[model samples]
Target: MTDIGIVGAGAAAAAATYVIDGALPDASITVFEKSGGLCGRAATRRRGDVTYDYGANYLKDDDDRVVDLVSTFDDGLVEVAGDIHVFDRSGTVSEGRDADERKWTYRTGLTRLAKHLFGATDATVHRRTRVERIARSDGAWTLTDDDGGTRGPFDVLLLNPPAPQTATLLETADWDAAARDDLLAATRDVDYRTVWTAVLGYPFELDRPYYALVNTDKEHDVGWVAREECKPGHVPDGESVLVVQANHEWSVERYDADPARNVADLADHAAALLDDERLADPAWTDHQGWRYALPESGLRRGARTPAEDAGCYVLGDWVAGEARLHAAVRNGLDTGERIVHAR
Candidate 1:
């Protein structure tokens, strides 16, 4: 029987788990996630009866494989129907070009994607277990956790962290020094766009023609503003929840600032761009800081060669060269199939 271990519980990891489980049903799979929640940056949260996807706005129907995979989980899927308006540098809002395509999320939340993928497999996911180190011996990999516990002897290992974090892991891994150094060099140069997201809720409905507003020129402080009401069952009939994501520059500037202050600033920006004043005051607010939001570059060609040759694999949206959820899922599916064939 094959023994497979995966690090991080993001979209790619979930997709990989789903594919690997289907291809190799007899394999023993184990996953380690540092955080309490799954799906990484494609995060979702609920406040009282209102559910919202605060990180990734929604998954697009860009890949046929992803479409087929999600189709199998019809009970958890919810298609979003609305237009996305663009806010130019001058603060004028217009309809966006991509709104013609369909957007999707889960009925419960985006996390259901991860839940459904993992639920289909016999894999055991260990949440809140941060892997501190990875080493190889006897053609097997051993993982050490931050809690001083060790788990390992797996035939294969998969890493699903962001590029920078993955670089750190490669740097500390007790593997071939030259290969590790090469991977570190390549991954270190994979730049990322940081984002600070704020979720605001109101007791009354927000009447707007568009469901979202994005910064087309990238000159605005807010990168995107989306309404939770666009997704069915996310918001109460009479209430609304607005998710505001700050641009890279603004997010980097205020990432360490007070959450209340940062959220207020985003709400203020949203009010101006949406031409609505009531949005400046939200009944409840939630905030999250994504240090590594989207990857600016894909994985270097030579970066994965060394790992793959050593029975290790790296998968993520960053590795796929596109930060979209569809890209990540596609990469994971491809990587899982490659692993299955390789074995």
Candidate 2:
């Protein structure tokens, strides 16, 4: 039987797990996720009667294969309502920038995408188990977690954490030193944009023409502001939830600042852009800081060949050269196929 090990339970990892489990029915698959959550930055949270996707706004219908994959389990799928409008650094809103494709999320939230994929697999997933070390011995891979526990001695290993985190693991791994160094250098070269997000809940409804606003030039302090109420079943009737994300520069500056102050500042930006005073003081607030939020660039071509040759694969949107959620799933599907064929 094929023995497989995977790290991270993001969308890509979940998709890979599903594919691998189906292809190799006798495979013993294991996964370790650092957080209690799945789907990485496509995260969601609920408070009282409201559910919001505070990380990735929505999944874009850009990839045909991913669209087909998601369509197989079409339950709870909901389209995000309204057009996307553009905003300039001066806070001027425009009507020209509507989406060319559809935006989608589940009635529950985006995390359901990962859940549906993983639920079909027999892979044993260990959540809140952070894999702190990686080692290769006896032609097998093993992992050491934060709690001093070890897992593996598997024939194949898949590293699915962000490039930086994956790089750190590779740098300290006990494996073929030359191959590890090559992978480590490629992983470390990937740069990311940080994002600090604030979710504001208002008791009153917000009347707006667009579901979301984007900073086209990337010069604005607030990067993107999305209306959570536009998604079906996300918010209660006559109430609203706004997700405000600060730009990379702004996020880096206040990433270590007080949470209350960051929320207040982001709320002020939202109020100014929306031209509504009530937004300046939200009824309730929530916030998240993503240090390696969006990958600015991907790894060099064929840089992972050495590792892949040794039954080690790294998959994600960054590895696919696209920062979209669909790209990550597409990469995952392809990676799973590769592993199956290799066996």
Candidate 3:
């Protein structure tokens, strides 16, 4: 039995495993996650009666692969076709017919999609287990956790961690010095930006439309605003929920700042956008900082292989050109297919 080890239980890892399970039905798979939960960047938080998508809010179904994968999950996903308001830096709003472009979201929460991918299988998932190092010995690979203990003799290993972190992991592996340098150079040239997501719940409703894509090049810090209540199954009746995404530059600047203050500032800025004073005070608020929210530069596809020469592969949105959940899932599926076929 070939043992395939996958890192990061996010959409990419889950999707990859889902694809691999179909291709290689008897192959053993294991997923390692630094957090207790499976969702990597697709995390969600429930505040009161409202469930907020703290990570990826919505997915654009522009590619056929994404649409096909979404169709597999019947009740797990819902399509939204409504008025989408796009605001430029000058505060000028534009509403177009493209608003009908399909936007898919999880019914209960984004994490539901992850759980669905981890369906009945012998795949071992180690949560809250941080991989300290990945090395090779006697033609087999070994993965070590923070405690210096190792899990090894794997047939394949997948490095799905963030790009920056992937470089570090390769350094600790037994790759040729030249290969290590090349991997470092590849990752060093790659850049990533941060984003601060502020999830707020208000007692009163804001007059703004359900989905507002804002491009404020001035004092405002938010780039996109999604009214959580507008999405089905997210909010209860009469309750208002909002998700504000801060611009990359602004999020990076205040990445380590106070969470409460970040949430308050986001709420205040959103209120200014709607010119409504009621939004100035929200009933419940939470903030999450994502240091690697989006990839700054595109990575060369097929440029990377397993650093330890093991069947382990690397997959994620960062390698797939976009940071959206759909892209992550597609990337995972593609990676899994490639691995299974190669075997």
Off by over 4 Å in 2: none
Q: Estimate the overall C-alpha local distance difference test score of candidate 1.
A: 0.90
Of the two candidates 2 and 3, the one with more favorable TM-score, higher being better, is 2
- Per-residue lDDT of model 2, residues 1-343, tens digit only: 9999999999899889989999999999998999999898899999988999988888888889999999987899999999999999899999847466799999889999999998898888899999999999988899999999889889999999989999989988988657788888988999999999999999999999999999999999999999999999899999999999999999999999999999999999999999999999999999999998898888888888888888789999888878889888999999999999999
lDDT of 3 at 157: 82
Sum up the clashes in candidate 3.
2
Checking candidate 3 for backbone clashes, the offending pairs are 157-312, 157-313
Q: What's the best-to-worst order under TM-score?
A: 2, 1, 3
lDDT per residue, candidate 3, 123-147, as tens digits?
A: 7898999998887666567888888
Q: What's each prediction's TM-score?
A: 0.98, 0.98, 0.93
Kindly report which residue pairs in candidate 1 clash with one another: none
Stretches > 4 Å off in candidate 1: none
Q: Of the pair 1 and 3, which is ahead by lDDT? A: 1
- C-alpha RMSD of each candidate structure in angstroms: 1.0, 0.9, 2.2
Best by lDDT: 2
Clashing pairs in 2: none
- Tens-digit per-residue lDDT, 278-331, candidate 1: 999989999999999999999888778877877889999999899899998899
